[model samples]
Target chain A: MKKSSCSLLILVLLWSNGVFGQDLLNLLEAEQKDENQYAPSAFMMTRIAFGHSTEVRPQNVLDVFVANRFWNTPEESTQSFVADRMSSRIALEYAISDRLTFGAGATTFDGLFDAHLKYRAALQRNGDGWPITLTLFQNMSYDSSPIADQSVSDDFSDRLSFTSQILVSKRFNKNFSLQLAPTLVNRSLGLSAADPTSIFALGAGVRYKLGPHVSFVSEYYQVFNPLESRTTFDPIAFGVNWELGDLMLQFMLTNSWFMVEDAFITRTPNNFNFRNPNLNFGFNATYVIHFKNKLKK
Target chain B: MNKVLLLLTTLVLTLSNDSSDKVICRQGSVSFFSYTSVENIKAQNNQVSSIIDFESSKIAVSMLMNAFVFEKALMREHFNESYIESDIYPKATFEGEILDFEPAMEGAQIRIVKGLFTMHGVAEELEIKTKIEKSGSTFTLTGSFETLVESYDINIPPLLAGNIAKTISVDFRFEYEPYEEK
Candidate 1:
C-alpha cells in the first residue's frame, strides 16, 4: 500500500506541473520589448510658415517646394490690382539620413540661388525624458542679379551671403508648439552703409493646430541693430498650413519679399503694422516622394 | 529508501513536463490590407512575439504598432499619428484558446481560435480559422481574419474617408520553437 501511494503521488505531481506551469500570456509578456519612444508630430512640415522649423525629412525622401509672393505698393500707380510685383522660388530638398537634410533652391526676386544643410542634433521624447528638440541650420546664397547700384560690387565672392542658426523648439502639447532661432548672417557687401558686415537677429515662431491636417502658424524676426541708410522693418508673417495626402500648402501674408534667410531677415522694407499694412500674399506648395524602400524598425 | 527514490524521480519528471508545455515564437509575421476605390493600403510587421502552451492549447500574441512598415512614409506617419494613435496606445495584444486542436497531429489541420483582440485601447472578441501543423517539436500556425475599423473606435476624416475601406483584412503566421529561458 505504501509503494502504491508513492507511485500515485509521483503521477499527480507530474500531471499537475504541466497543467499549472507558467501561463502562455505571461511568457509572451516576458519576451515582448519596447523600442525608443520618440515624440510624434512636433511640426507638420519642415517649415512652420516662412522659416525653417525643427523638423527634418525621413531618409531617402525628396521634397519639392514651389513658393510665390505677390505684393503692391500704394505709391506705384501703374498697378491695376493689388499685386504689382511678384517673386517666386523653386526648391528641392532631400534627406540623406535620419538626422541630416540638404536642400537647394532658386529665387526670382533677387536672382539668387540658395542651398542649405540641416542636422537634427537631438529629438524630444514622448514623456519626461527630453524637454526640447534641437536642430542646426546653415545656408548659403549667391546673388546673380544685374548690378543696379554702383555701390554693390560685381565680384562673385562679394555677392555671397551666409546664415547660421540654432533652432530650439518645444511642443507643449498636441495643439501648441513654439520655436526660437538665434540667427547669425554674414555678408561681404552690406545692404546699406549702416548695415554691418555681420547681422544678429532672433527669430520666433508659433503654431496652433486646428486639426490633424491644418494649423495656424506665425513667425517674426527682430534684428538687434536697425539699418540707418535705408529704412528696414522686421519681417513678420501669418499663415495657414493645410496638408493633403502627399502635398502641403501654405497661404501667408507677410512683410518679407525674399525667400532666402539672409535677405528676408535684414532687408525687408515693409512693416506688418495693421495701420499701414504692407503684407504680401504668398502661397507655397510642397510635395514629397519616397525614393527608397521602407525600412522596418 | 524506495519512497525517497520515487520522490526524486517525481521532481525530475515535473520539471521536464513544465519545460515541454511552453513554446515561443520571436519573429511572427502579421500583415493587414485595406482595399478602397481610390487605393489599396497595406502594411506588414515581422517582429511579433507569440507563445503557446500545449497543455492547455492556449496562445498569446503581442506586437508593437509602430513596427508596421508601409510603402509610403507619409502614410505610415498618418497611420500612427492620426488614425491608430500609436503613441497613446503603443502595443496590441491577443490571448485565446485554440479549440479542436491536437498537438500530436502529424500534418496540417484546421482549427478554430477564439480570442479577445485589443488595439487602440479598444477590445473586441475575435474568431479566426487557422491551419496548424506540428512536426517534431516545432509548431506553425497560419490564419486570416477581417476586422472593422469602426469597431476599434478609429475615426477617419471626411476627406480621407474614400481612401480607406470599412473593413481591414489581417493575415498572420508564426513558427514556434520550444521555450527556454534565456
Candidate 2:
C-alpha cells in the first residue's frame, strides 16, 4: 500500500507539470510574438510647395506699386505684369522620437536665399483618446543680399527672429483635418522703436484630404502693429500638396511668396512689407526623396 | 487484472488522440506596410504592426501615421502637423479573422480572410486573399489590399488634387503560435 501511494503521488505531479507548463508556454509565446511585431513610429517625406498670395488692404496698395516697379518695366506691357512671387521650396524632415521631429529647408527665388530649422513636439496623440494635437514651432531666416543690410539694421539683417505658435488641430475624420494657431512674434529688428506693440499675431489653417496622396491647405494670419493705427498686417494663403509615392509637390496662392519660415517669422509677404504692394502673387515648387534605415528587433 | 489492463489502454488511447489532432507553432512575427500618394507627392510607411492567432483565426494590427518617413524631414513634419494630423489620429488599427482555415497546412497555401479595419475612428469591412504556410512549428500569413481615402472620409485638398492617389495600398505579414488551454 505504501509503494502504491508513492506511485500515485508521482503520477499526479507529472500531470500537473504538463498542464501548467503548457499554459505558461502559451502566455510567453503570445508576449514574444507581440514584441516581435514591428511598429514603426517615425516616417519621412519630401515636401515641396509653390504658393502665391494677394494683399487686399488699402495700405498694401502703395507697397504693391513699388513691388510692380521693381519686377516689371514701367511700360504698359501686355504680358500681364506678375508682381511679387516665389518659386519652389524644398525641405527634409527627420523623426527624432515617437513624438518629436526636426526639420530644415531652403527656399530660393530670384536672388533670395532663406534657410530655416524647425522642431515639432506632439503634446497629445489621437489614439491616446484625444482628438487634438498641440504643437510648438520656432524658425529663423537669413538674407544673402547686401541691399538687405542697407534696408534693415545690422541687428535684423542676419538675425534670428522668434515666433511661437500653438497649433490646435482636430481630425474630423480620416480625410479632413482643421487647426487654429495663435502666435507671438518677437523680432530682433528695429521694430521695437518703429512698432513696439505689434509683436502679437493670430492665425488659423485648415487641411482637407482628397485621397491617399492629395490634400488642400489654407491659412490666414493677421499681425497687429502698435506703430501703425487702423491698419493691421494680414496675409492669407491657399495651397495644395500632392504625394506620388516617394515624391511630393505643393502649389499655392498667397500674398506672401516668402519661404514658409519667412512667411511666419518675418511676416513679409512676397518679400514685400505693408509698405510695398503689387498684389504679390507667385508660386513655389518643391521635391522630396527618402532613404530608409531599418533596425533589427 | 484483465479489466484493469483494458481501462489503462482506453486512457492511453484518449490522450494520444487529443495530442495528434492539434498542431502548434511556438515563435512568430508580424509586420505591415502603407503606401500613400498625394498631389505631386508619394509616400509610404514600410514598418507596421501585425498579430495572428491560428486557433481562432483572429488578427490585430496598429500603425503610426508619423512613421511614414519622407526624404525631407520638413515634409514629414508638415505631413504630421498639417496633413494627417498624426497627433489627433496617431494610430490606425485592424481586427479580423481568417474564415474556414481547417485545410491550412505546412506549405504555401492561399486562403480568403474577411474582417473589419478601423481607421480614424471609422470601421470598414475588408476582404483579402492571404497566402499561408506552416514550417517547423511556425505559421506565416501574407496579404495585400487597397483602401480609398474617401471611404474613410479623408479629404484631399483641391490644390494638391494632382499629387495624391485616391487609393492607398496596404500589405501585411503575420506569424502565429499554437493555442494552449489553461
Candidate 3:
C-alpha cells in the first residue's frame, strides 16, 4: 500500500506539472521573440500648405498637388480692383524613403521654379516631447519674373532665392494640432536700397478637426524685415481641408495670392488690415498615389 | 506488481511528453467592422498570435493594437490616438476555454469558447462560436463575434457616435500548426 501511494503521488505530480507547464506557454512569449516595439504612424500628410509638417508619406509614394491662389487686386494696367488674376502652382513630391522626401514644383505667380528637400528629424510619440515632429524644409527657387522695375539694372543671379524653414508641430489630441515654423528667405535681389536680402519670419498654423474627413485650418506668417525703411506685409489665411478617398482639397480665404514661399513670406502685396481692400480666395488640391503598398511599420 | 508499477511510471512519462495536445499560430488574421448610417469602416491585422492547448481546452490570442490596417489613414489614426489609446494599451488579448470539446483526429468541430477579452485596458467576458477544421497536420479555426464598443470603455463623443456604430463586429481566423519544441 505504501509503494502504491508513492507511485500515485509521482503520477499526480508529473501530470499536474505537464498541464500547468503548457499553460504558461502564452502567445506573447512565442510571438516576436526578438522584435523591437512597433513604430507608430505619427501624422497623415506630408505638407500643411506653405509649412511642411513633420508628417511624411509612406516610402515610394508620390503626391501631386495643384494649388491656386486667385486674388482680385486692383490691376495696375486698369487700376481696377477686379478678378483679373491667373496664378497657379503645380508640384510633385515623392517619398524616397520613410525619412526623406524630395519635391520639385513651379509657381506662375512670382514666375519661380523651385525644388525642395524635406527631412524628418524627430517624432513626437506623446506629451510635450522636445523636437516634436520637427522637419527641415529647404527650398531653392529661381525667380523668372520680367524686370518690370526699370529703375534698377536686372542682375540674372539676383533672381535666385533660397528658403530654409524648420516646421515643428504637436498633435495635442485627435481634434486639435498646432504648428510653428521659423523661416528664413534669402533673395539675391533686394527691393530697395534699404531692403536687405535675408528676410526673417515666423509662421503659425492650427488645425481643428470637424470630423474624420474634414478639418478647419488657419495659417499666419509674421515677417520682420531688418531694414527699417522697408515695409513688410503679414499674411493670414483660413481654410477648410476636405479629404476624399486618396485626395485632399483645401479651400482658403487669404490676403495673399502668391503661391511660392519666396514670393509671399514678407513680400506679399495684399494687406489684411481693414484699410486694405478685401480678402482673396484660393484652393489647394493634393492627390497621393502609392506605387507600392509595402508600408511596414 | 513491480512490473505493473514500472509500466504505470512509463505511461505517466509518455503522457507528460505528449505535445500533440498543443498548437500554435503565429500569423492568425483578425478583422473588425464598424457600420453606421453615415459610413462603414473596416480594418485587418494578420500578425495575430494564437495558442491552444487541447488538453486544457484553453485558447489564447494576442494582437498589437496598431497592427490593424485601414483603408483610410486618418481613420486609422483616430482609432489609435483617440478610440484605442494604443500607447497606453498596445495590444488586445483574449483567453478562454472551449466548452465540451474533444480531440477529433480528423474532422471539423463546432465549439463555443468563453473567455475574457481585453482591449484598451478594459476586460469583458465574451462567448464566441468557433468552427475548427483539421486536415493532415494543420488545424484551421474560424469564428465571428459581436460586442459593444462601450463594453470595452471605448468612448465615442456624441458628435461622432452618429457616424460610428456602437456595436462592432469582430472576425478571426487562425491556421495553427502543432507546437514543436525548439
DockQ of each: 0.37, 0.07, 0.13
lDDT of 2 by residue, B120-147 (tens): 6678999989888877666777777878
Per-residue lDDT of model 3, residues A139-213, tens digit only: 888877787677765677677788899988887766778889899999866467677788899899888878655
Model 2 lDDT per residue over A183-226, tens place = 77655543434555227766666667655566777777656552
Estimate the Cα RMSD of every predicted model relative to the unseen true structure.
5.7, 12.4, 7.4
Worst 10 residues of 3 chain A by lDDT: A34-43
Model 3 regions more than 4 Å off: A1-43, A74-86, A127-131, A150-156, A226-229, A274-278, A295-297, B1-27, B31-44, B53-56, B69-96, B103-110, B114-182
| CA deviation > 4 Å runs, candidate 1 | A1-27, A75-82, A128-131, A275-277, A295-297, B1-20
True contacts kept of 1: 0.45
Give lDDT: candidate 1, residue A10.
70
Interface CA RMSD of each prediction in angstroms: 5.9, 13.0, 6.2
As a whole number from 0 to 100, the lDDT of residue A55 in candidate 1 is 89
Among the numbered candidates, top TM-score falls to 1
Query: What TM-score, over all chains together, does every model reach?
Result: 0.85, 0.52, 0.70
